[model samples]
Target: MATKLLTFVIFLAGVLPAADAAIDIGKVLGEHREFSLFSSLLSSTGVARATNSREAVTVLAPNNTAVVAALRGVPRGADTRALLSDVLSLHVILEYIDADKLELLAEGRSGDGTRVTTLLQANGKAQGRYAGFVHISVGEEEYDRITFTSGAIGSPWNATFEKAIAQLPPSVSVLQVSGFIFPPGVIPPQPRARQTSMPPAPSPAPGPMAHPPRQPLLPAPAPAPPRPTPATPNLTNTPPPSGNVIPIPIPSVDGGMNATLPSAAGHRVASSWGVAGLLFGLVVCLIWSL
Candidate 1:
């Protein structure tokens, strides 16, 4: 019985180290000082605790500088915690991917890339077929260069894989990327490129036309008093003249003449008086001769 118990104790001791060999994400990240900020974020958001339950996962951990840059524009508040939680979850892919697997994928696909789902998808926050997925592809010029792209709306962001931070084959792998992988709606869409050209100067609004001053109303000059009609002379009451007298004309108001002239009877009377005078002269001359 003593020999059998010693053999069982040795077997138990042999099994304990293998159990303790599982990767601790927090410890893996904590070993690298450059990832200190990312590690703290993972702790604060409780993502580090949840990582152990997953069978396999690849953490694309951004360096301190990259994390700082990503947080610069994010506003602070209660929503920030939730936002950061979502963002950190997006960084975690639900599969084991290391440099070797990435090279194999790149070679197999000819740079077309492979899509991998993330923790965000597992949380059910991502709904569509491609939502909360990371795109892994090789650089066009350099076949060895691997790139990770986030499927952000309108503006997708890309991060180049710098190096493998830590790797435990077929279980967990933490990769150092050039920048943070921002999920759709995480970063504010760039304020639609500030209308730089200065909005076309608003067309000058047309102004009202100026009117001329009105003159005071005047009673039209009383029609000029009708010119007084000239009075007409009464010819019926005037008596006819007995001698050969000619009346001089007088200018009337209308620039015309009004008068009487000598007639044939006056001429005949003059002729008769001249003949009688001549006969008396002849008779007196004969008496003187006797």
Candidate 2:
């Protein structure tokens, strides 16, 4: 039948693109927060979880007085909940991208500027330093800040800024990127190490002029000494001289070939060393017939 209905139409075209990616993450969490927790932390610091799930997002949020003055030089307790969860996971960003994808990621990017990456991250690193510069003159709603540099030396990324205030959300706002667009030794881009892709160079084994029979190289001579040969004697007392034949050898095809035939109840089972010496001779003949 048309190859099992073309393998059930290639398994329903691979289950309709994961059922349309679970209905677009339930219509992007019921329409926007832009993947909130500052954009589901740039896809939880793994980077662009499907580019912040499309549809348009331009978060410049950082309000509760810029998240309480970006956590006033942290230090309240338990190491201020791991240094404000790595300075609020490097300020989240995966892209639902608005403000024209932050001016095409800031045109030709210059120094003291570029380093935008977030999905926040911890121990294995990367929880902040997403300051790729895009400060469009503060208020009047043109806010878009992504700045960096806060509490440095031996990295104390305020524990992703107290895990971005315990993963905010009640409608999203978080502020405090103070004095109009960051610069005091600008910080935020830490979650670094990720590179990975390199495994593709193994296809050269076909040469010998693509198979023919060319095996020639010979030049290598001299080195032959040890001589002496002449001793044959003990003929086993000269015997056996009537009807001598001895031939029987046929085995080959890589020896003992069978072409499938083993199961006669797996040759009557019993061999873990003959069933442990027949259960230790039936427990020593049941303790000598008790």
Candidate 3:
């Protein structure tokens, strides 16, 4: 019995180290359907193999939706493969950070948050205080919320923690993030083209008539007759004829006799002396009769 126990113990010691030394990221991601595209990217970019050799590492895997969104407008070619490799490298961290460790770091850090180095630093693609670094922090208002922000200057890309995918402890920890965490100078996703119908063309305006209708004609108005003018009398000084003169009666005043005047002249002419003489004769006759 002592010989059999010694052989079993030796076998167990050899198997445990090999199991803990390497992790298959593709297998872990393949289990989840939502990470199918992400898993493919890791395989194609060779990020999965690179990650397996690392001692301790954390991966922020975006869902298929996020992968699709980030790939929008990106052309396919050798250059594209290199770009994707660099991007996936940035998503990997050199140290294992599980949900518990992330919460503890959040609680311990100030408002500036904690910075962690990524695989980019190991590959020598980037070097600096912020290059190949990502900032992880908890939301100020919502303590349960966590965010991953790009360390690149002036980069607006950020992703929120969705849920823990798998945790192998000291070896590997994969977490699902809301979207892609892009660094500076990386082109963002383009919007889908909308299918819209064109508006109908306006009807052509009516053209002027070729031949216009004629109007009916009416008779012209008659001219008015001329008015008659009166004749003016002649004003000449001429003597009257001798035989043609006719007498006209002139009435006297104050109960005296009426005197006779010559007609045929335009006007009557009784002298002043004749009028006085007639009045005087009447006075004499009146005295005699009394």
Candidate 1: where are CA atoms >4 Å away? Answer: 1-17, 20-22, 108-110, 140-144, 151-155, 188-290
Worst 10 residues of 3 by lDDT: 259-268
* Model 3: CA > 4 A from native: 1-21, 140-144, 189-290
Worst 10 residues of 1 by lDDT: 187-196
Which is superior by lDDT, 2 or 3?
A: 3
Best by lDDT: 3
lDDT of 1: 0.76
Enumerate residue pairs that collide in model 1. Answer: none
Candidate 1 vs 3: which has more lDDT? 3
lDDT of each: 0.76, 0.38, 0.77
lDDT by residue (tens digit), candidate 2, 175-235: 3233222322434333435559988999998756656776669855767876778766536
For the record, the alpha-carbon RMSD of candidate 2 to the native fold, in angstroms, is 40.8
Instruction: State the weakest 10-residue window (summed lDDT) of model 2.
Output: 158-167
lDDT of 3 by residue, 1-290 (tens): 99999999999998876555467888878888999999898889888888877888899999999888877756677877877787788899999998889877655556556878888768887645576788787765666788787776655547888889999888889999988776666555444565487789999999997887765597666788877787554345543455655654455677554654346341435465578889999999999999
lDDT of 2 at 268: 38
Output the TM-score of candidate 3: 0.58
